[model samples]
Target: MNVAENEIKSVMDKYRKFAVYGLSPDPTKPSHYVPLYMRDHGWEMVGTYPKPHEANGFTIYKSLTEIPKEYRKFIDVFRASEKIPEVVDEAIALGGVEVLWLQLGIHHAAAEAKAEKAGIKVVSNRCLIIEHKKWF
Candidate 1:
């Protein structure tokens, strides 16, 4: 479940759909800008946040569970590192999540273990948008 070079590209190529948890309305925020960047990079992004009904001019859902059963493979988490335990638990419950991404500066060993145990590929303390750009 740990990420490797091949796994990263496989997720991007196979599952272009993404749910951005904690997506923000403010452009200045990392949560807001990362998803926007992904959308611009050709990834279909779903804003999953409680505060914003819309982000980057697209409607935002409250959680991954709210997203239709079909789109769950791509998930990028922007929650605090300390809160990752709860977030990871939620992701495990939300079926079909292929990639569990933790944004830059976020890391939780216990949550990472749980996600891996659930057979979910995890990328911790990394930036997906940045990685995409770098690879391209």
Candidate 2:
């Protein structure tokens, strides 16, 4: 299972927990289904948002700072491409965030650079669910 050029998947291979940013509470939302699908493939997924609340039977975090220390390995983002820079910053602040995965159709050069510069691997414009499926 080769990750992209920038994303090596080392942290992904070593970690079981995943923090999903921009996760939608609504089941009909694409952000909701994509991570949900990845969860079905044996990946532990945590839903995150910009609000401190609850959604889909899970607690919503206002930012990556809200994530717990133990589960900070992979940070998957589903927001607009333009917002990725902020996500990258959040990932760096959280520490131990290995993979900075932007959801399908989302990409930003600056964000990728930020993550890479901070030693976090980058995977933009890719779907974790789809990648898992293809790998298996």
Candidate 3:
């Protein structure tokens, strides 16, 4: 279920809680700030990173599997393309994941296909913050 470019906004509107993979600790980084912006806008966000880190006091999972199943509805991925497949696979295994979103400059066709095939809405290479700004 690859979401068309124009439908991204509608998709964004549909989900409230988001699990951001590769979310950074640095406030200046896109992975951090993008989710932060969403959080500030009344969106609920949790984060997962390779290392232990905090994003505005939110519990940052060390891996996707660590996230609670109910919080996996929308996954906004900030990982590089090379790392996406594993994340996508984990998302699928986690279940209840409605959307798989790859952040700006990150795109993995295989991963996208896998998620789409699993009936998860897929959006690639788009900045969530930029998209949110347009619709919110």
> Considering every candidate listed, which one attains the maximal lDDT?
3
Span of 10 residues, lowest total lDDT, candidate 3: 63-72
Q: Model 1: number of clashes?
A: 0
Model 2 weakest lDDT span, ten residues long: 1-10
Residues 12-98 of candidate 1: C-alpha lDDT, one tens digit per residue? 677677778888888899998887787788878777787646665866887778876555676788899999999888888866877
lDDT of each: 0.80, 0.72, 0.85
**Of 1 and 2, the candidate ranking higher by TM-score:** 1
Against the hidden reference, what TM-scores do the models get? 0.91, 0.84, 0.92
What lDDT tens digits, residue by residue, belong to model 3 across residues 3-95? Answer: 987898788888888898888999989988898788888888888887997678778988878888766899988887998889888888888
Q: After superposition, how far is residue 114 of candidate 1 from its true place, in Å?
A: 0.6
Stronger candidate by lDDT (2 vs 3): 3
How well is each residue in 43-109 modelled by candidate 2, as lDDT tens digits? 7777677655556566567767777866567777888887777777877876888777777899888
Candidate 3, residue 60: lDDT? 94
By TM-score, is 2 or 3 better?
Answer: 3
Model number with the top TM-score = 3
What stretches of model 1 exceed 4 Å from their correct place?
none
